[model samples]
Target: MQTTDPQGSVPSDVPEPPPHADEPRKLEARLTDADRVYRAVVSSGAAATLLLITLIGVFLLIGAWPALKEAGFSFLTEKVWTPDGQPPRFGVAAMMFGTFVSAVVAMAITVPVAVCTSLFINEYAPRAVRRSLTSLVDLMAAIPSLIFAIWGLFFLVPALAPIEDWVVAQFGGWLPLAEASATGGSLFNAGLIVACMTIPITTSIIREVLAQAPRHECEGALALGGTRWGMITSVVLPFGKGGIIGGSMLGLGRALGETLAATLILSIAFEIKPRILENGGITVASGIAIEFRDAKEMGLSALMAAGLALFIVTFAINFLAAMVVSRSRSGAST
Candidate 1:
């Protein structure tokens, strides 16, 4: 029952606490404080990542200033990297060419193989075999680049020699890329090694993405008198296309930055050449790895500039990949 309190005010069984309330207010205040702390931590993490990249760019630009001042654009255009010469003529044209070309070759090999393998694993493989094969792929990803480099040097190079020779015999007369020099460390060989390295990563990514492809859509297609192949073509492939593209681009990014394998697999060269089979190729990372130890003054600066170039290339590739992925996103209206 209601009753009059102090003067004429009515009071009920449940009454509001005074301003001095303890536990509830304290808990609410604590929750708010914790939320603010969490936000600050997350914001700091993002800000730190951005700051680190900016700092790296600053350092590279500052270090490369002397070389950029003297050489101007020749550092980019010329095809020589002689630090000991009279004029100390150095250029990254050959390295940049090799980097892009070999990465392209790797992508060419990796994309199709990865896509096919991933499809089989995700769509067709029996459950028992699927787990085993996926585990094997994960094992491959865990394998060190040094191990791949050694295997490429001792085994793959020799094994591919016969194939290279045959291709040269058949197509060397017209197709420059198919032309093979006897040197085992040709760009083609390096590219193959790079492909091998990229495959596991690409396949894993594709498989994961493809696994998420709408199962009901696939079933719907199959229900409409579609064969397995027809269903995949009409439903699965379309759904996974963006994922496949994104995975391929990620693999390409890895290939572009690959240092140890590329360095060990390719015979570093200073001049640019059209033949992909040539023994002379030097990727940017490989260039830095091989040159950094011996570099002094301008040479160091040149290496810095080269590093900057690779950074720009990687950033651009990632940016473009993001655009491609966004454009190709499933369920999005064009």
Candidate 2:
């Protein structure tokens, strides 16, 4: 039986009832004036960014319409580029091929190096040197593209010629792609330069992602008798996979639009050049850069069309990359 104190209806042994048992708690935070102002500012910034992107797309479309109408679908398929001709015929086929090929080659070289560099910085570097190394890598990205172009043109192109020749000699018979008639200035050289340009940015992204891998999981793996390398493979690599992909794609986009280095390193040719080691390839960005000064009205329109294609492709790649990153462990998607 419930006991009652002398001065109270119920004894102290009875638990007190909770306040507002039937009412729902306010889950949302109450916005103050400052919070409202902040939200409004952020919303305006986002809206402005979207408006700018829309304006750019509209501009490109308007500028490209004349060329697209003149060439029709053949604008995509034809291999020749002679927009200033009497009838004005041109196509992005070969230039687009070069763009993709060079970008792919750059990624092929950049990804492994970036991944290794990031892993080293995050997991293997000495604490004393880590900060310095990270700063150095980041500083590399701030260097101008024109500097890289000039360096590649004057130094890198000549230095790579011997190596390119050796490769061609070793594999020319069995690997058709390894053969080259001229190795001084080629798509391969452009790709190498672009890869160098892309490495720092890609590595920075990957390092940040890898650094964010759950420390507890890494410790757990080690506690379970896994080696450091094993722990890294099991914990870090898996955690940063999405970031790696995202970083690589971002690098690819950079490589695709790289104008100066490619223009300086590549010997332009209109035909499709599957042999990257040969001294003949041209990318869309380089094409536009080279033709812009001398281009007539039709040529300018054709160049704009090419730029539109590249813009669309780059946008798609980065969009997909953002989606991938958002789905991964490292993304703050919310």
Candidate 3:
């Protein structure tokens, strides 16, 4: 029976009917076994990812041991990469330089174009055309890198030769990387190919992220009498900064490891060149691709060492990119 107040009426604050009989049991189930099991499963997946990365590092280190032992510390500092000589002297100084320059060039060209393309699809395109533009960018990412390599080697190089020559003739002396060969297969040319390969993927990634920007923020900006460009500058750009950074870095990784494009186009010089367009620089991936076919024993080990260095560099870069993405997702900026 229900309790009553001073009179015969039921108490003003009636009990809440003792919650449903099954509610407490359901609540307990969620807080105990179910929650713990879900947490453990997610944690294990993350741990597995880290373990795989560690195993890869260990394997590369072991594979590279022979060259390291033979060359000592000089393997890193020395510029020579002649692995077939008697007593075999080798180093990756040149490949490292080429890797840096080519990847930098690729990122510089790819990032701006990708950002603009993504913004166009996400912010400015007609609604009917948005899907089509996005699909076009997605299609480009699926094109084989081999196709890009072949096109760059035969058609693209020859077509761009005249323009490259003019740049070399006019600014080669004053600008650091303005030098291009008559054939147009310089470090810059290879970088351009890599940029083309990267842009589609980068644009796709950025457009996807920008699509997630809060709708209210966008509408509010326009309602405040902001122009389209003003809305982008004040609202969309800030909102998608993390997506932009993450996509660009992923594109950088592609540029770093591009093999056939660089190998087929570069003159494969053994030293750093200030002029980006001059004949040949040997990037790590291209070096491995070119020499792996003929490498034997010690030569093989030396190539493994170069490959390992590339792995380390790419790993560090990706790790930093992940951190930046994290900051962006958490709404932090600095």
Clashes of each: 0, 0, 1
Ranking by TM-score: 2, 1, 3
TM-scores of all models? 0.88, 0.88, 0.85
lDDT of 1 by residue, 1-334 (tens): 4668779664765555557845566333325778899999999999999999999999999987888777788988977886546688887788899899889999999999998898898878998899999989988988888888889989988888887788888898899777666557877778888888999999999888888878888899999999988987887778888898899988999999998778898887776777888677888999999999988788899888889889989989999999998988854542
Model 1 ranges off by over 4 Å:
1-31
lDDT of 2 by residue, 1-334 (tens): 6777678676777665556767885565558999999999999999999999999999999999999999999999988989999888899998999998889889999999999999888888999999999999999988998988898889988887788899999998788798887687788888999999999999999898889988998999999999999998988888888889988988888999999988988888877866889889889999999989999999999999999999998999898888877777453431
- The collision pairs in model 2 are none
Instruction: Give stretches of model 2 more than 4 Å off.
Output: 1-30, 331-334
Range of the 10 consecutive residues with the lowest summed lDDT in candidate 3? 22-31
Q: Residue by residue across 1-334, what tens digits does model 3's lDDT show?
A: 4577677775767633445674454332226788889999999999999999899888889989999899888887766777877969888888988888888888998989998888888877899999888888999999999998899888888888888888889998788778554546578889888888998998889888777777788799999999978888788788888989999999999999999889988987777768778887889999999889998888998999999999999999999999988877623542
Q: Best candidate per lDDT, number?
A: 2
Least well predicted 10-residue stretch by lDDT in candidate 1: 21-30
- Report per-prediction Cα RMSD to one decimal: 6.9, 8.2, 8.0
Tell me which residue pairs clash in candidate 3.
267-280
Q: Which residue runs of candidate 3 sit more than 4 Å off their true CA positions?
A: 1-48, 180-183, 330-334
Error of 1 at 31 (Å): 8.6
